[model samples]
Target chain A: EPEVTQTPSHQVTQMGQEVILRCVPISNHLYFYWYRQILGQKVEFLVSFYNNEISEKSEIFDDQFSVERPDGSNFTLKIRSTKLEDSAMYFCASGGRETQYFGPGTRLLVL
Target chain B: AQTVTQSQPEMSVQEAETVTLSCTYDTSENNYYLFWYKQPPSRQMILVIRQEAYKQQNATENRFSVNFQKAAKSFSLKISDSQLGDTAMYFCAATGANSKLTFGKGITLSVRP
Candidate 1:
């Protein structure tokens, strides 16, 4: 089965540095989303992208965060400046319909 | 707005036994979708089963089945003939007209040999 794929399975970055997490959603899926989970917390929605624009975002998705589908296949999340609290497992998902499929996830560590 | 709740934090079952994980959702929208995702020690999120609100017939995938009660706004997962591989954290989620998913805190299930 086709699945969402993400790059840089794990990343370690210095606080205040910028980081970009990349994802290649399932080719035919039209909607894409980003979610994060703190070490022991529930997964929190970050943003949703469709038609090259942000469709919805959570309060946690502040100015520091931005998502781009630079190419037809790549969806990337950029954090202008990383904070210690930003460290978590970031997941990328895509849906052809109501059922969305997830990637293995990228673990981000901002120290 | 939509919210999903998983009251049980953890559970354990003997191999080959049946286990049920509870999940409840509150949603104003009449049309929506509910899902159960499994996250093993690897931390990879995998879709185990899904139920559509309009479908009265529960959905069953292999040994994973869902008991969906639209009136009570409840959706629970039942795993039959549980195996050690079933050990994982299960999350119940719901999405409405808007495709953003609201997820519960998740419950950890351990299958004992």
Candidate 2:
């Protein structure tokens, strides 16, 4: 079965540095989303994208975070300045219907 | 805003036995979707089962089934003939008219041999 794919399975960056996590969602899906889970915490929604625009975002998705569909297949989440608290497992998901498919998350560590 | 709650933090079942994980959600929307996702040691989130709020008939996928109580706002997962491979972190989630999924704190399930 086709699945969402993400690059750089593990990312380590210095605090205050910029980091970009990349994902390639299922080709035919129209909606994409970003979610994060702090170690031992529930997964929290970050943002949702459709038609090359953000549909909704959580309070946690502040100015430091931005998502882009730079190409037909790539969805990227950029953090302007990484913070220690930003370290978590970031997941990318996509779905044409109500059932969204998740990718093997990218573990981000800002130290 | 919707919130998913998984009351159990951990559970264990002997091989071939049955295990049930509880989940509850707070949502006002009449139409929505509830899902159970399994995350093994690999940390890959895999969809185990799904139930549509509008459907009264519960959804089942092989050994995995759900008891969805729409009126009570509860959706629980039942795993039958549990195997070692079933050991994982299970998350219950819900999404309403908006597509953002609200996930419960996952429950760690260990299927013992």
Candidate 1 lDDT over A1-111, as tens digits, reads: 898999899999999999999999999999999999998789888999889999999999999999999988999999999999999999999993379999999999999
- The candidate 2 chain B region of ten consecutive residues with least summed lDDT is B93-102
**Model 1 chain B, poorest ten-residue lDDT window?**
B94-103
Candidate 2 lDDT (Cα, 0 to 1): 0.95
True contacts kept of each: 0.60, 0.67
Superposition error at A95 for model 2 (Å): 0.7
The DockQ score of candidate 1 comes to: 0.73
Enumerate residue pairs that collide in model 1. none
Deviating ranges (above 4 Å) for candidate 2: none
lDDT score for candidate 1 against the true structure? 0.95
| TM-score of chain A for the candidates in order shown | 0.98, 0.98
The alpha-carbon deviation from the true structure for residue A38 of candidate 2, after best TM-score superposition, in angstroms, is 0.6
**lDDT tens digits by residue: candidate 2, B29-111:** 88899999999988889999999898999999999999999889999999999999999999999999888999999999999
